[model samples]
Target: MIKLLSLLALLWVYMAVVGATHTADLSRKSFPKGFLFGTATSAYQVEGMASKGGRGPSIWDEFIKTPGAYFSFFKHLLEDINLMVNLNFDAYRFSISWSRIFPNGTGKVNRKGVAYYNRLINYMLRKGITPYANLNHYDLPLALENKYLGWLSHDVVKDYADYAEFCFKTFGDRVKNWMTFNEPRVVAALGYDNGFFAPGRCSKAYGNCTAGNSATEPYIVTHNLILSHAAAVQRYRQKYQEKQKGRIGILLDFVWYEPLTRSKADNYAAQRARDFHVGWFLHPLVYGEYPKTMQNIVKDRLPKFTKEEVKMVKGSFDLIGINQYTTYYMYDPHTSPPKDLGYQADWNVGFAYERKGVPIGPRTKLYEEDILCVQAYSNWLYNVPWGLHKAIMYIKERYGNPTVILAENGMDDPGNLTMSKALHDTTRINYYKGYLAALKQSVDEGANVVGYFAWSLLDNFEWRIGYTSRFGIVYVDFKTLKRTPKMSAYWFKKILRKNK
Candidate 1:
């Protein structure tokens, strides 16, 4: 039975590759000159030498130790670089695993780990693909977590700065673009408030975890994360950036929250949601403090920065990477406040999928009999292209129109589909067409978006989702660790082709 199944899968894959089509609705010519098109992946997601190369375990490694609960890209650097070059991608944004460099999170440098990244970056440069290196991507070294409970304690700020400094001194020359942390908000909320990610912790009422105070921990973690970012930026500016001529930034995830209705209450609810989401990070970076809504609602629970700290935290980035994917409708929940308190509960708003029996957008397949909005493989991801425009504009109007990168913008399909169906990927192609158009519209209106990177280069591990969600233009055959360009890959090639 196993042999037969393998043979059938190979046959389908061959059919899928041969049947693939190359088509695109938009072109690179639609955007400003020097605007880059690239793909993104994280160290752990793509570099699958989890325990190899003298690397230590990350919190994620320990968190997902259950049998059959892991997957990765198997670290094919040269081949992956060649793939991106062939797709006409101009850049690659990838994370550096913290544990890979300092096995114990600090002190000794792992030579093997350093050599591997040097090779990867060098190869990318040789292939004319710019390297955008992100210092951390949620894979905190387990040693730090065990020692000082990771981001929860203030002690981590200096240690994290040290780690960032090491990376700056080492990789700052060839790698010109640097992002401190990817989605620190997600790190705070999902890892602390909901217990859904590694080093999972939450209030008993919020999620299943052995230890945490969801209401307070998320704020504390966020506060430290922000300080850590600021310290790293400070170090780079003082020590490395001027010499290397590089830029540093942080990656933030934003979900545009539209008012469920035009009523003042709904509008206020939407604003509150926005303040609590992207504003949670950007407000501090751009304005030197948390959003007023968060400060007022969370009150004493939200940590305050010292006067000196504010100076360092403010204006810490050369650019901002917005990892936008979806949007939601928010309205004033007229009911009384909840007895069980947490980061989400503190918002004092309610989420609604539809109003007056009509969804915010068209449905992909009429998801349920009643829910009309189109959705991706992930339940939370909805197909709403306008959200991208709104998200970029929100930063423009509110956050001083600082330079932005559409760091991650792509939808996923279920990973279980047969090879033929997966490679066809008409829906993924449409998703990109709609989104790229929306992004182009924003750029035309002066959003200062210099580049765009699709969510991934291959179907790799998706943290909590494991291997169940496919968010790659290049399909990977997990059975054989094979790489095949999906129709969307050819679509990108055609649109991004410079020779035309």
Candidate 2:
């Protein structure tokens, strides 16, 4: 009880420092007409029935068999969707697991797997919640990786298209909004370069893995991923975009990089990081080639797109999903040119959470209650809401303001915190309030922003860190799988209510 009271007191102080002074005079009406208010969840992060319903394995299935891996979330779809309805959300953005639909990757479709999503999607529309379906979210079918090394090979471009075409033919009638891939940069960098994600492969100089050429594989994999996205977009436009009247796009994660100080070197370094990060993908999609900076730095290692490939790869979307999270200060370290190289090392920049003792934002972590909790459950996600506004404007100015969706945004609370404390998540409430206000500000500034989806509807699983990190507005007791709405959830409900 003493601990509970202390948490409440800390939250009050934290709220005052960050965002409590700003009244949430904004609501769903605050956004543009036809702009949506929703929440997001990926299948792998929430669905646990990895082997059920004739589902085939994805690389994640094998990866989670690791000793510390937490077990699954597919059982609660109906209950979870119902929660969305009760919360007054306008839509739900979720992914279709590739292995679940085509277990062997390409040869045959899983009827049971298709039926499950059919039920979920149908129910979402029936309840007045729009269904925004994303085709892939990092869970590539394991068979594809085994057969042809997945994204590393050009073969993936065709296989991925076939799978996507099947999905369009099957589900496109009802699911009007679609996304091709989610965060392909993370797919290439973390999976191949740093080896933090599944299908982990890296050179010894980069990460722990049995065998991988970190310098080469990341570029090759990203090239193939770009081709895959373009191929899927082409197929959708040719076959289903007209008949079904559906829209397709890809989701890219962006971190706003502010220069640490007034130094020219720091500003240039920050630009370099931005170019290598989002520009790595967006430049190719927009202009049919890599950014000039990337071309000059990466040189021959970055693959060239032939004339036909370039035509297919460029201007390949009806919308862009931007997952903006936190911000960091970047500066050029001016280190000596590397001998043993890798993709990440190419950035040649330093990241600082603080400058001259002023912290970047708040660092709310597992046991740092002694100080103000600015760190979230994930070490990387500091609560810096203003970053969202800067990132959206950058996309507006840099990428032609193509229709954008704020796909994933929110911070996590430490899982070990007591349910009472976790439910009274005033910090999470203020986090959304500040970030959403920033989002609205971007729209007011003439950014072509279409919608905003909270990172999650409920806490399910956090990869690598397992269940230790909880990111849902609705709390889940991992032991019992019971769902409870935190204070943040009710706050969001009020904002999203149609009458408001």
Candidate 3:
């Protein structure tokens, strides 16, 4: 519990440095009619009972024994939906764990697992919340990983498509929005290139791991991921989308890369970063090939899609979900190429958080006036709202103005703060204010942006970071599994009010 003095000090910090009146004049009224507002959570992140309910082990299930968000979502289904209804949210974006549906990744269906998702979807519909379901969210079935090395081999592509088809047959009637995969780039890079996440694999030179080729595995994994995504979309379109009338897409994470200076080298370096990041996945989905920068640099190391695969891969989505978070300054490293090459090393660029001495975004303090703060929640997230604008515009101009959704956008707070300090999330409120304003500006300038969903609705297991950071507007007490709305939630409630 926070002492009275600490609470007073926090309140004073907000009122004095970060004025309480900084909430912008923005609301649902500020955007186009039918714009979506929702919060996102992955299955492994929130829906506990990882081993129960006939659910098979995801790679995540076997990797970590430290449980987070282990409270039964199946037991508290109604309470969660009620919370969404009270907040005036339009939708809830959640992933269906692949192993939950098919315990062994293939062969047998888990009836209990199907029932759990059906209950969750039905409750959301009854509460007037639209369901936006993602098929995969970095939670691959352990069975697949053990079978043919998961995404490393081409065999898993057929299995993934089969699983996606099963979900369409079972749940497509109610779930209108479908995403094949969430951040396949992250899956390839962090899981293979750096060995940072679950099913950890990396070359001996890059990280401590039993096995993996940092140079080749990342590319091969990404190739299989793209193939899996396209195959799923193909099956949905050919078999279910016509009857179900639902749109399917893939979610990709993008960070706006600004050149540190006007020098040609730096500008090219920044482009290389963008090409190697989002373009790694999206370029093929749009143009039927990898980015020129990548093809020229990595050459044979980067996989190529055949003539038949090219036809299947191009124009694969009705929409694209871009998860915009922060911005980084890029500069030419101007160093000799290392003999040890990896996915990130292929970019050949240097990342800078600041230019000269001034910071790109202000370093996080207890409070700041101009809404410039960096490293608030995680090391990568900076409070540069303009990054959202630039990211959306880039998608528009480069990708032929495709329908876009600002899918996962939000910052986080420390998990150890007392209830009083945690509840008063002024920094978070300011974050939404600035980003939403930038999103509105993009729409005003003719970007075909459709929806926005926050990074999460509740604090849950955040991959390698675990529960050390809280990214939700609703605070969850880990001990009792009780959820209390933080000030940011109320801020959302106020702006989203029908009268406002």
The candidate that wins on TM-score is 2
Give candidate 3 misplaced runs (Cα > 4 Å): 1-23, 67-69, 365-375
Q: Choose 2 or 3, whichever is better by TM-score.
A: 2
- Misplaced by over 4 Å in model 1 are 1-25, 66-75, 362-375
In model 2, which runs have C-alpha deviations exceeding 4 angstroms? 1-16, 19-21, 66-73, 364-374
lDDT of each: 0.87, 0.86, 0.87
Clashes of each: 0, 8, 0
Evaluated at residue 441, the lDDT of candidate 2 is 89
- Write the candidate numbers in order of decreasing TM-score: 2, 3, 1
Q: Per-residue CA lDDT of candidate 3, range 423-482, in tens? A: 878778877877888899999999999899987788777888877889989898888889
lDDT of 2 at 269: 88
Least accurate stretch of 10 residues (summed lDDT) in model 1?
365-374
lDDT of 1 at 192: 94
TM-score of each: 0.92, 0.95, 0.94
RMSD of each: 6.3, 2.9, 3.8
Candidate 2: worst 10 consecutive residues by lDDT?
66-75
Clashing pairs in 2: 48-72, 48-73, 48-74, 362-374, 363-374, 363-375, 364-374, 364-375
